[model samples]
Target: MRVVLAEDNVLLSSGLKLLLNSQGFEVAAIAADACAFLAAVETHRPDVTIVDVRLPPSFRDEGIRAAAQARRDHPGLPVLVLSQYVEQEYAGRLLADTRGGIGYLLKDRVSRIAEFTDALRRVAGGGTAMDPEVIAQLLARGGDPVEALTAREREVLALMAEGHDNAGIARRLVITDNAVHKHIGNVFLKLGLSAGDSGHRRVRAVLAYLRRYGGNAPDATTPHH
Candidate 1:
């Protein structure tokens, strides 16, 4: 697959280019600043774009801004935003777009070559990958951003990520089916997803869950969420 990489760190940039090349992935373009990054995407229309959250000029969220802009212009191109630390707010912004094919991972994860490469492939295939640290952060504060949910509701969340349905979650957690239903209600309420269509609620909830704990998908064990 073709990729456009954006990072201001020269050593890391060259290292990543080499790594990707050795792995047989074509490096279609590379940029050191957000402006150049966007221009390259517009020019190359690469299959995926790997971006560092901190880039030239502000050295803040330039990468994030670029990712958001690229998503706006291209609509379906995959974007992976790398950062040194987890920022829940930033992850939320990325997930809010819900166009599929977005990722938010820690910069250090690039060293885990296998997983990082897989994440890029996933994003290119229209899947989400989030950093584990971000997942732990969201799980630690699992509740309605607007309202609090019960412990049972949180348990239901953990089970949802486990690929459980109301019946399955009820059985696994030893709760009544009705109880699981109520917990689902509370989850939707707390997450401010109550008004969405029924068919899409579960997907949205999963997106919220991933947005919360995604940086860690390379590892399945739910971090202390």
Candidate 2:
């Protein structure tokens, strides 16, 4: 798969390019600044783009802006964003489009090469790939609005945010498929997401959960090597 990479850090970018190349992803373009990042996307129009949350010249949110702009310019383009911090507000913005091919993962995850590549492939295949840290942050914060949900219901919701399907969640929780569906239904009802079609309701439920509990705390797990 062709990939455009946007990262200001030279060492990390080189390492990433090598890693992705070894994994059979063509590094179509590499950009060090926001302008170049946008240019690369328009020029290369790669299969997917991996970008950092910060870039040169002020280094605030240049990469996020580029990602948002790219989506506007090329709708449904797959992109995976990496960040050193959780920055839930940034995550919310990244997920706003929800065009099916998106990812928000902590940079530490790069050390787990297998999982990182899997996430990239998943996003490229039109699926979401959210970091475990992101989910841990949400859970660390109080889920008061969703507190009315039973423990299992909350578990289902969390797993959903982690990009797990009903079957995956069921297996992880060691429960029946029917039980998983029932918990998901209860979650939707408690979260007031039952009004829309199933797909729309699922998005609403996930967004509501994030808006409520995200941006609370640092991830509890040690940064992976």
Candidate 3:
């Protein structure tokens, strides 16, 4: 797959490029700032883009803004954002798109080559891959009906948000598939998400979790360059 990477840190960007290349992904372009990142996206039209949450000029939310703008210009553009910390607001703003093909992960995950690559591919294929830490924080701070969930049900919901299916969750939690199903059912019920929901139940649940904090997050429409 072709990838356009946006990161201000020279060493990190170079390392990521090499890593992506080694994994059979073409590094189409690299940009250090929001403007340049948008230009690269327009030029390369990469299959996926890896962006840092902070970029040059302001070193604040430029990367998130750039990614959101890119998605606006090119709907359904696959983006995998990397952050030094778990910034829930940023993650929520990005996830707010809800068109799938989104990923938010901590930079530390880069060290886990296999997992990182898997997430990239998942996003590229029009899937969601949220960082576990991000999910945990969202669940922790969420209000009712999320507060109504039991501890185990919360764990199941968190894992579900991380792009894990029932089998995957079962293996991670060392529980039976039936138990995972039961916990997920309870999560859906507690969250008031019904079988008639428009989208995939799992995705709806994750979106519900994000909506708890998304209300306070910055709007995705960033000032154009």
Highest lDDT, which number? 3
Q: Estimate TM-scores for all models.
A: 0.71, 0.85, 0.90
Whole-model lDDT per candidate: 0.74, 0.78, 0.82
Task: Give the clash total for candidate 3.
Answer: 0
Q: Give the TM-score (vs. native) of candidate 2.
A: 0.85
How many steric overlaps are in each model, in order? Answer: 9, 0, 0
Off by over 4 Å in 3: 197-199, 212-225
By TM-score, rank the candidates, best first: 3, 2, 1
By TM-score, who's the top model here?
A: 3
Q: Residue 4's C-alpha lDDT in candidate 3? A: 97
**Candidate 2 residue spans exceeding 4 A from truth:** 195-204, 208-225
- Per-residue alpha-carbon lDDT of candidate 2 for residues 79-140, written as tens digits (9 for 90 to 100): 89999999777888865665667889999999999989988998888778788777656556
Candidate 2: clashing pairs of residues: none
lDDT tens string, model 3, 1-225?
Answer: 999999999999999999999999999999999999999999999999999999988889999999999999999999999999998789878767768889999999999999999999988988888888776665554354655666677777777777777888888888899999998888777766774665446876678656754433211221111
lDDT of 1: 0.74
Candidate number with the higher TM-score (1 or 3): 3
